[model samples]
Structure formats: structure tokens, C-alpha cells
Target chain A: MLAMSASDESARSPGVLIVDDDAGIRENIADLLSTEDYRVYSAADADEALHVLEAEDIDLLVTDFQMPGRNGVELIEAARKANHLVPAILMTAYLYVYEQLDADRRKDITLLRKPFDADEILREIAARLGDGNAPKR
Target chain B: MTIPPAAGPKAPPSAGADSKPPGNRRTLFGATILIWAVTAGLGILFSVFAVAIGLQAATFDVMRWLLALAIEAPLAAGIIALIWYSRNMHSATAAGEAGAQALAHSEAKYRELIASAPDGIFVLDPQAKVIDVNGAGEELFGLSRAEIVGHSFMEFVPPERLESARSYLADRLKGLRATELYEATFAAADLKPLHVQLRSQVVRPSDAEPYVVYIVRDVTAQREALRNLVETERWASMGRLASFVAHEINTPLTNISLLTASISRRVSDPEIQERLKKIAAQGRIAANITGELLKFARPGAISPIETELTDLIRAAVEQTDAFRKPGVELRDETGTRSVVCTVDPMRIQEVFVNLLKNAYEATPRGRVRIRLQDLGSLVAVSISDTGSGIPPEIQSRLFEAFFTTKKKGEGTGLGLAISRNFVASHGGDITLTSEPGKGSTFTVVLPKQAPGVRATE
Candidate 1:
């Protein structure tokens, strides 16, 4: 299942790295992904998320937008600058966060509201990562 | 009838007279006049005899008076009768003046009581003209006595009830002294329609013409309060029904999602399989959301149990570790006494988690302290943060439902409100104290064994 080309790896199944300040949410999301047989990893905040990104092969990021320090948006920008071709899903309780984001950056990302349902998070993740389960747009 | 403690015998003399022999004043006046007449007659007869003897020898004046009266007893008796008549007339005139003074005092007292009674009192003549009204009556009608007295009672009563009221008054005057009960709308002096309960009783003084006395009582506030109670009950019933519906939907929806996922996992067609999986996932999510909504609709169901205070705090902190700021220290300052309380542990932890989360978010670089202590029968727990405290403007409404300072996407305003409800249900109280720049502290106090031991939650 290993790919030799960088683009092939980037285009592979999404590697979701959950960065939330709530352990229950992180655990629930991880548990949800595990039940679906998707490889999932969890971090408490942006710093831990970055550490995981550096050490592991990641294709997608799902991080909360209001965590301490550089939040989900900052993480995505940093990851992109580091030659990481990953699409991210930004989770926040604030709807205005999406409005504030640049239009170009928003195209590659989706926003999830807190207290979110497991199904919505998974569907959004699949759509953003171009999973074969989602209709191609 | 036995008098009340307030009307005991030791009450003032004036108060006693009202309850004692009612006609004693007239008897005492008659006795005083008779005594004054007899004493004046003796002095006048002696003066007349001395004047007759004055023409004789001055030395014989006193002796002559005695001897002359003894010799002409019949003439002396006539002279004595004349003196007695003059003295009796003078005493009678003085008694008349005293009686008049007494009458004036009693009249003044009667006037004072009628003027000062708290109940709205009104007097109506046989023809239904307002005779007299107290200040309370004036206020009830929003008019001065001068304005309402000449006006017929019908002017105040609702039109439909006016004729009936007139008949009632007529009947009261015919010795059928019964109280009439009627709820009618009256026009206030300001022309506002005031709902009132009017009771007309026939007041008949023995010598005076009978008048129909009306007692008007306003019941608007009481009626409005009852209406509000009924409205509140209706909303509560609706909330209960909505919760039941949500619970019903959540159960079956959960089952459907479970079945769908099983079917999708067994499918062989990859494209169809993926779509089915997504559907199952979305279905599960919908079910969870329904469950959350149901939780909000229904009141908490768990019965409180005696639980350790420190244990609850630790559980909440552990549950919310993901939300805590990195590098932020958590410190517990619990006294040696293991503070225990009867409460729904899960719900109490939820409250703690919310407060801790808010505190964690408020602080940037300092420690968050959680302290617990037992103060007699009550246990207190405080969570303090060293971050930027809550602003003063938001503190007043911090626990109000749907009030939140966090940006719209950041927090639901329901957390603190729900937390307050949970704390209150335990027979406990919660308070928040904050300094705009220094930080904030939230304190919760609960009884050792939940609040209502004899009642069910």
C-alpha cells in the first residue's frame, strides 16, 4: 500500500490529525474514525498537532480554530509552507471564522461547528479529501 | 363575645367606655343636676330671711332669720320653692351645655373612623346617590370624594350590573339587610376600566335613615398573577412533550444507523459501499444530535447521591483536559475534611467542567486553582483562574440563559445557564466574582446531603 511518488502519497486516503482542546471531542472523533477503520491520530492543540505532522505521514488535518497559540488556520498555512500538500478541515463554534478566511484558502478547506455529529465530520472529511465515496465536483 | 388580646381590660379608659355600659353618660348627668339644685336652694332661703331681718336690729339678723322661719313655716316654704325653681333652671342649663360637649366629642370620633378606614368605604342613599366616601374609596375610583359623592353608584358600576345594583340597594333599605356580591368593571377617575369586587351591606342607625354601604376591593394584581402561572404551566407541558418526541426519534434512528452500517460493511460493490457507509455515518450523527436536543428539553433525571467533593472536581478536570490550556497548571486546595455532598455526580461534574473551561480560556499564562472546603453543614468549591477576567458588563448576565461573551462560533450561551440549573437543583447556589483585568472566580455551595432530603428530584 506504500506509494513511491509524493503526489501519489498526497492523493492517497486522508491522514486525519485531530487537534481539539476538548479531550472528549478528540476521543469521540478518534473513536468514530477507528470504528470506520480509518487511521486516526489525536492531539490536544496546535503544538501537538504540528509535532505529529513532523513525525508522521499526514494527508489531511482537522483542527479546532480557537485553540491556544496558532490555531487550526495557522497550522494549515504552516503545513502548506512546509511542502505539505494537505487539505484541512477547520472546526470552530464561530461561523464568522469562515467569513474571515481568504477565499483561495477556503476552497481547500471546510468548517465544522462544535458539538458536531460524527457523521457530519466524516462526510466533510471525505468530501474535502476527495474520497471516492464523495461525488466529484 | 370574648374580646381579643389587643382589646384587653387594661386598654385605655376611652376604649373601655365603648364596650362598657353604652348609656352611662346620661345617668351620671341627671344625678349631678339633682345634687346641684338641692344645695343651691338651702343657700338662697337663708339669704332671703337675712335680708328681711336687715331692716330690724343688725344684731338680731341671724337669730331673727331662724325664729322667723320657725314661726312662718308655710311662708318660708313658699320662698324656698321659688329659690329651688331658680336654682333648678340654672343647673339644667349647665347640664345641657355639658351634654352638648359630650355629643360633639362622640361625633368627632365617629367622623375620624369613617375617614381613616383602610377599606374603600362608600355610603349610598336610598335613591342611589353617593352620600359619603373615604380616601380609600376615592383612590379606588381615582377620584376625590367631592367628585364621586354626588354621582350615582351606577356611574361606577358596569352598565349591565347597574340595574341589578339599584335593586339590591332598594332591597337593603326594606330591612332585608343582606350583603350583595358583584364583580363589576368601574371607570376610574382617569377613565381606566378597573375590575373590582363590590359588597354592599345595609347600614341602619336606629334614628337615622338607612344607607347602603359599599366595600370595593381591587383584585387585578391577583388575577394577573394567576394568569401568569397558567401560562408558565402551558409552556412547561409543551417542553415535556417535545422532549418525549426527541427521545422517541433518537432511539429508532440509532437502530437504523446501526443496521445501515452493518449492511454497508457487507456490500461488495466498492462505489455503492462507500455511499452506504457515508449514509450510515450521517444517520448516526443525526441520532446523536437528536439525543442532545432531547437532553435539553427534559429536566435532569438523575437522583443526587452523597459524593466526595474532591473526587468530583478531579473527574471534571480530567474529562476536560483537552480543553485546558497547555502549560497551564491545575492546583487543588482542599481542606483536610473530606467535603461530601448529595448530588448527581455526572451533572455536578458537567458544571465543574464548564466553569473550568471558561476559567482556562480566561487565563493566558497563569495557574488555575480549584479549592474545596466544608463550612459546617455546607460545602463550598471555588474555581479561580489567573487569566483576563470576565468583563464587568457581561458578569451580571453570565449565568442567564443564552448569554455568552465567547464569539458565536466559540461557545453556546447555554453552558453556564444549564450549569446554574444543575447546581440549584441540588439545593445549592453558584456565584461568580470577577475583576475586569485580574481574573474571575466561580463559587458553588451545596448541602452535604443534597438539598431536599424528604422530596424526590
Candidate 2:
């Protein structure tokens, strides 16, 4: 369910950053998204994810909203301030965060539930990148 | 008239003599005129006697006849006395009627003020019976003015409060004493007890019997409301302290349970080891208690993630089945929709599980119904149980920590309370509606979207 860029033939594979407080969750999601041929960078929390984003040309971010120190929502806001256009998907165990999203941010933001299916995550990433009807990204 | 002082004393004081001069002025005037004519006649007679016998001795006799009328004027005096007496009698009668009318007007004004006073005023006789009551007084006692009048004050006073009522009446009977205010319970016609505070006094003239004046006010509802407010605050503070205590105890408790389980695994003898396993099992149960306790105290940090509500609700139902018996039926009513919302799925799942567990426990082998409806910006989920519903006594305190109807080992009573707190942290609330002997429905309402979305298809 991921679409590849036309410039992919000339350059490296598209990079995806994974930010979650739980290490197990970070590893599991990174492995699943990697099977679809996207390069993956994993961060334990907001601070680590910011370091990864600065060093890499990341196309997508999948982060949990709640974390120690800087929370996931705060991290998303900071990332947007640093780079004006970056697509992000926030993960939550609790159910009510999506309804609270702002209209501007919601247009770019996609939500994924915890313990989510691999196929569902891949398809959401494909749709958000404006690759309509593509099988892989 | 001036003949002699000696002759005045011997004269008879008849009406003719007493009216001889000023008292008989008209008669005197007429008599004098007659005398002058007679004297002139006598002189003419003397003169004419020389001419011819014209003025004779009869002329002198006519003068004496006029003098007699001047001395007694009986008919004229009688008429003056009758006229004076009649005029005095008529004026005296008119004055008496005017005085009577003024007295009647003042009495009517006194009656008006007594009847229309704003506060209830009751006039009780010395015998402690109601002599008069104002409109306000009759309305307060829920009795007609006629029913209350002439009735003893004891009739409305409940039997339990009769002594208090008598002491109150006794104070009113003591004239010139300080006024006393007392509260007493009275039974209404509907058999409900009423609370009344009366300010009563005895009023009287210096020599008259004392009359009781009572002013009554009702305060039953006001007092009850105040009591409920105080009771609620007490429970709320207790719950807050319990949560803090649980948090403090949980840290050590976590280590203790872990150590006990490790030691139980190291034990050697089979029988001794089995007993140790039991000990570890009990320690683990204690750990579960602290875990639930921590849920109440710790705040959840979660991110917005989209998931289907029906699927989440089903997961809660599945968890609830662990405690349900074979006879129990756990069912879900979920409509097909994207039913999408961004939430912390784990926390939301926790809330659903708590509600479903509560519904399962409320009924024994009864049907549990789980319903989910997408309500625009939010979603409403209801978990209902067909069990002996919550008693009214406990219903109000159902969310209070450590308040439970279950046996000591069965419930810590923090499930609903923690559920309430968890829902509130996400800007939602848990509400419980119950009817005794019928059933109970617990509803959890959560905002379907995250913080900033304007809902769209």
C-alpha cells in the first residue's frame, strides 16, 4: 500500500522516522514498515526523533502522543515549526485525540491506533503522500 | 310699689304680686296704658261733672282692674318655660349619636390590621387554644381558619414533640417575660413531618389575662439541602485522600510482590513449594489491588490515534467475559460506520473495560448490553445490566473511592471512581443511572475527535 517516488530510481529509498516511548513498539513498527522497502529511523522519544529528523531527509513520521518530557503532540508542533511541511501520524491507546485535532493540522495528520494492522498503516502512508491508488511507496 | 319696707314683709307673694313689675313687663306696659286712659277719663269726668255727669266713679274702677293684671302674669310665664326645655332635649340627643359613630370606626380599623399582617400571627387564649389566626397563619399550618380556631395547640404537635410544644406555650403564658423562639416538629395532613420555628410572646394590659402571639416559619427543605451538601463534601475529601494513600503504598507494594514471587519459585520441597506458590499468588493479588489504585492516582499521557469505535467496544466486552458465568450473556449493539476518532486507544480501551466489568458485576447471570452510537463530535457508549439495581442510599456515593456493596475481597470500589477520573482527563464523564429491582445503565461519553478537528466526512 506504499507508493514509490519517480526520483527513487536516481536517489536512495524514502526514509520513515518512528518515534515511540515504548522500545518494543518502536522495533515492531519499524520492522513492519521496512518490509515494504522504505528505509526506517527509530527514536525512543521526542528528543531522539528531532535528532533523527535533522540528520535525515525523512518523508514520514509515526509517533506516539504521550511520552516523558516532551509529549508526542508537542513534538509534532515543534517539528512543523522547524520544517513547514512534514506529514505526521500520531498513535494513542486512548480514543479521543483525533476529534480534537485542528483543521489545518488535521489535513496533513493521519491517525493510527496502537496494535494496528501492518496493511492499514501502509495504506494510510500511501494516501497521505498523494499517491492515489498506488500499491507501495 | 314703694309704699313701705314694713308693708313689703307682710305682703302675700302670689303670682300676681311676684309678677307685679319687671317679670310681667308686657302686662305692666298694657296695664299702665289702661291706667293713663282711666285717669284721663276720671279727670274728664270731674271736668264734665261740672258740665254734665260724663266721667263718673266707674272710670276709677276700670283703672284698678288693669293694675290687678300686671301683678299676676301666669299664662305668659308658662309658655316661656316649655320652649326652653324642648330645645335643650333635642341638641343633647344629636351629640350622643355622633360620639357612638366615632367609636365604631376605630374598632373596624383595629380589626383590619390584625387580619392582614404578612407574617403568620396567631392569637392564643390563656387556655392555649387558638382564638384567631391570620391568613398567613392558616396557610402555613395547611388548615382552614375555622379548623384551627378553638383547637388546642397540641393537636398539630406530633406526640414525640408534645413536651417541646408545651414548654413553648408555657413561655408565652408568662407575661412581661423575654420573648422566646423555639422549633418544633408538627405532623402535616399528608403525614410528613414539618419543621417550624416560632417566635412567641405574651401581651396584655396591666390587669388583663395574657394572650399568646406567635410568628411561625417553615424551614424543612432548606435544612435538608444544607445537610446533603455537607455530606457530599465529606465523601469527596475522603476519596481524594484514599487515592493519595493508595499511590504512596503502591510503590513499596510493587517491589514486595515481585520479591515474593521470585522467592516462591526458588523453594524446594513439593508440599512446601505449593504452599509458597499460594503465598506468591496472594502477593500478586495484592499487586493487582495496588495496580488498580495506581490507575486512580496516575494521569495518562496518550497521543491521538484513529480507530473504529465498534472494534474498541468489542475488545472491552471480551475482557469482561473473563468474569462472567456461563449463564450470563454479554452482547454488543454497534452500527457500521467508519466511526472514526483520534484517541489513545489503550486508555479508551481501559474505560470501556471498566464500564463493561461494572455492568457484568451488577447482575449475576443476567444480560449485559453494550451499545455505541456516533454522536457527531463525540461518541456515546452505554453498558447496561439487568440486575438488582443500585440502592438509592448507595447510588449517590457510587463513584466515591472505597465505597462498595460487595464483600471485602470482591471489590475495592475504585473501578467506577477511576473510570470517572479517566474519562474526565480526556474531557468526558461517566454517568450512572439506576432503579432498584429493575436495572442500571452506565454511560461513558468521549469526544470522538482529537483536540483540533472540525468534523468532516
Candidate 3:
């Protein structure tokens, strides 16, 4: 699943995992991605999100920073420990918390401030995935 | 020697023994002289009779003469001793009278000192009764000296503070504590509460009983100022918390906004699209409010560069000229000289723009004037408008966040507050002067070089 050929990439839809404690935000983001020809999985928290990561081959992980029990940063760390080196996007309303992360760790993750335009997040996802069939206008 | 005559009735009371009546001295002198004369006369007569009766020879006998001489000498010595004793008694009386006069003078001096003191000085007897109170003490209690004296000090203390005040006095009198400073609330003549600071000590006079002396000062104003300071600090912290809450709400607002836009793009029905547009606009309004709150809460960083202040002010005036109402005129009075200074250009420009816009908005048909000046170590920009000025009560709260005189949907009330924060971050300040019927002027002053920024010139 990690090494798909050009022909397979065009045939199979890219999978995205959306995690947030807020059901409204999580479902809205899932609805947007599904409309863009992407297969989306949703979770309410880090534990549920990790289970989905283990069960399905997710191409991208999008999560919120502040949550119940585990935060977005820790989930990203746990995913790497599970040998899932998927590209990640960390969404936060708190700029100070994002700034507090280790520089090297932050370099690998794309940060999206909340209340951002839909076009902004889509642009970041497409750039990170780097596929010709990525979501377009 | 005879005793001297007494001084007359008009003589000073401190005249010592000399102040006695003249009639008494004359009587005493007369009696002394009479006793000596009578004794001498009797002796002579007795001697003559003895001779006549021939008890002895008519010629003098040496032994008899010697006995007569011895008797006369003793009488003379006794009279001299009486005069000496009277003189010494008079001297002692004089010294005692002088000492009493000196004591009276000293007591009068101390009375004057206490009367003139600024702090309320109270002299209390052992029973805590007010034996004496100064002029200031009278003024403090709003009562005359007659009303304040002869009253228990506890009578002036409010019920809530009476017990504590009693304990403090008791501790001082009993030597149980050495703390002389205390604070208490006292009731004035009209029962108004007075916050006072008292310094009291036990005064032990050798010639009198031990008593308490208190130096009291009114501290109500100081306490009120301190309370206001604490309240201001509390509001400042609340502002920070409010900004944090605004940040948290932004995420959901983003979801609402983006989701609505997404749906609007996919829908083909004109009616649904129009409704969706309204919802998006409302969401944007909420977003704008939170954005302004964040700006006032955290001003972030400033980038300083060497720039001419005259140019900066001109640009701000031009940007805000659009806000001028019909018939209102704007004039730029800045001269040609370049007043170069190290400052955050964007932040400082915003400050000027905010002031200029406020000036233009205030003057409906009057003139707005903007001027720039270069002081040696500082620079100033003044914006004046010929408009109905702010009332004094509202002027104090003008810079407060969310405080506005503008109508609903016309202002967010964060413009001046954020502008002040920006200027303060650059080590500057804004000042205002206004007259009710005349006009208002706002002045922004900044140092030649921003704090922590190296001089570029």
C-alpha cells in the first residue's frame, strides 16, 4: 500500500483520517474531503484515531492539538512509533502552543491555524501529498 | 535692723516675700521696738529704786555692774537672732514663688505646641477618657473641643472596631505589647465612617499619673487609591483571559465559515445560495470581533527601522482623509525638515491613522489639523479637531477596551486600545486634552530611538 505504481495511484482513492474532539469540526472536514474524491475516516479522540490508523492504511493524518487525554503532537509521535510514517497536519487555535514544539519535530509537520480558509488547508494537503491527481479546483 | 515694708497690692504674684501687706510688716516692727524699749526702761527704773532703798552703796560695785552688763548683752543677741531668721524665711518664700512661675510658663508652651499640631493629638487619662484634644483632632471628629473632651475614646470608635481598639489600648497600658501603630475605623460627629492610622504611646510623667498620647491621621484617601489600583489590575488580567477565550472560539467559527462556503459552492439553487451567503457574512462578523480582541490582547513583536517621522505622519493623514465627513476639511501642518527616528513604522503609522480618523469623525463641519514636531530627544504628533469635545467622565475611560461612544455596528471599540498598545510597545505614549464646547486634541510622543533598538544614524 505504501509503494503504489502510477497506474494504481490513479485507480485507488487516497485515504485521510480526521481526528478532533469536536464532532461538528470533525464531520465538516470529513464531508469536505469526501466531496473532493478522497476516502475519509473520522474519530473523536486520539485512542479512536490510533485504532483507525492501525486498521486502515491512511495516506494523511489531520488532528487537533488540544483534546481529551492525548494531544495531536503525541498522536503524531505514537503513529511514528507504530511505523506509520504518514504525512501529518496539526490544526490549532493556540499559536503559542505550536511555537513551543521542538524545532526539528515541527519541521516535519504542517501547521494550520484554525478559522483558516478551506482553500488554504487544501493547498497544504496537495503540496504534501505531491500527486498529479490531488484535489484541484 | 528693722524689717522692710511690704510691696503694694499691685506687685507681681511672683514677688516672693516682698508681696506681703505693708500694714502687717509695720505692726510687727512696732512690737519688736516696743518690747526692747520697755525692757530697758524697767531695768533702769529697778536699778534707781535699788539705789534709793540703799540695798547697795550709792557708788557702783564692780560685781554688780558686771552682772548688769551680761544681762543686757543676752537681750541684744536675742533680738539680732530674730531679725536674721525672718530674713532667711523671706528669701526661701521668694525662691519658691519664682519656681512656680517658671513651671507655669513651661506648661503654657507645651499647650501651644499641642494646639498647633497638624495630626490629631489626644491626651487620654488612664480610664481612656479624652482629657485633651488638639485643633486637628477637633476638625477630624467634626466637633468642638468641648464636645470631644471628657468623653471616652471608645465612644468615637464604631462597634466593629471598638473591641480591637480597647484591646490595643489595654495591651499598651499593661506593657503586654510594644507595638505603637494601629489602624481603626472611627465614627465622626455625624456618624460618617473614618479610616484612621494611630500611633499611640504611654506617657509617664514624674509629677502626674501615666496617660496615653495618640497621634492620629486620616488614611481614607490612600486606602481608596490602593483599592482602585487592585481593581485595575484585575480588569487587565480579565482582558488577557478574554483574549484566550476568543482564540478558542475561532476554531468553531472557522468550521462554520468554511463549511458554509463549501456548501454554497456545491449548491445550484439561488435561494439556498443567498441564505448561505448571509450565514457566511454573520460568521465573518464574529471572526472580526475575535480578531480585534486578539490584537489588543497580544501586540506581538515590532520591527524597528530608521524612518523620517514627517513622511510617516503624511502617509497616515492621507490614508485617513477618506473618513472626513462632508464640509469637514483636513490640514497637514508638518514642515519640510526630516525628523528621522528609529521606530516600528507600521505600528507608529497605525497610531497616527487611528488618531487622525478619530479627529475627522468628530468634526462634522469643522477643521482637523495634524502637526509634527521634532524635539531634541523626542518627537511629537498632534491631531486636533474643532468638534464637540469628550465629556470629562467619558474621557477617562476612552482608552479602555470595548468602551465606545459610537453607535451600534459603527465601532468595535478596540481601535484606540490597540493603538495604545502598539505605541507602548515602542516605548511611547498618547495624551489628550479636550474642552466641552470647544474641541479636542490628541498628542502622541515617542523617544528618538525605540527601546532596545540600536541607533541607525
Best by DockQ: 3
Global lDDT scores for all candidate models? 0.68, 0.65, 0.76
Q: In candidate 1, which residue ranges exceed 4 Å CA deviation? A: A1-137, B1-238, B241-245, B248-293, B300-302, B335-337, B391-393, B452-457
Q: List, residue by residue over B1-457, the lDDT tens digit for candidate 3.
A: 0101011122222333433434445655666667666766666665566556445555556546744754674477457746854675566556656755764565466567767878898877778988778899999999898887899988888988888889888888898877566888889887877889999867654445667778899887898899999976875786788678787788789788769867976899999999998888788788777766766765566667898998899889889879999898887889898899888887789889888888887888889998888888888889999998999999999998889899887678988988887777778889999998788999999888889743111
TM-score of chain A by itself in each prediction: 0.81, 0.81, 0.86
TM-score to true structure, per model: 0.41, 0.47, 0.55
Error of 1 at B201 (Å): 22
TM-score of chain B of each: 0.48, 0.54, 0.56
lDDT digits (tens) for residues A88-128 of candidate 3: 89987555456567677776688887766666677777777
Task: Write down the lDDT that model 2 would get.
Answer: 0.65
Candidate order, lDDT descending: 3, 1, 2
Clashing pairs in 3: none
Give native contacts recovered, as a fraction, per prediction: 0.02, 0.00, 0.42
Q: Each model's number of backbone clashes? A: 5, 36, 0
Q: Tens-digit lDDT track for model 1 on B1-457?
A: 1111112223221332243222444454455555555545654665676766665666675767665654465455555655765676567556666765664566566557656766687777778888778788899988887888888878887777778767767777886655756677777767777877778766554444555667888876776788899966764675577556664464345345544554554567889888877776666566544543444444444467778878888888788777777878888786556767788887788889988988888877788998987888888889999888878788888876556778854665667866777787777899989887788899998887775632211
Candidate 1 vs candidate 2: which has greater lDDT? Answer: 1
Off by over 4 Å in 3: A1-21, A33-135, B1-228, B298-350, B365-371, B437-439, B452-457
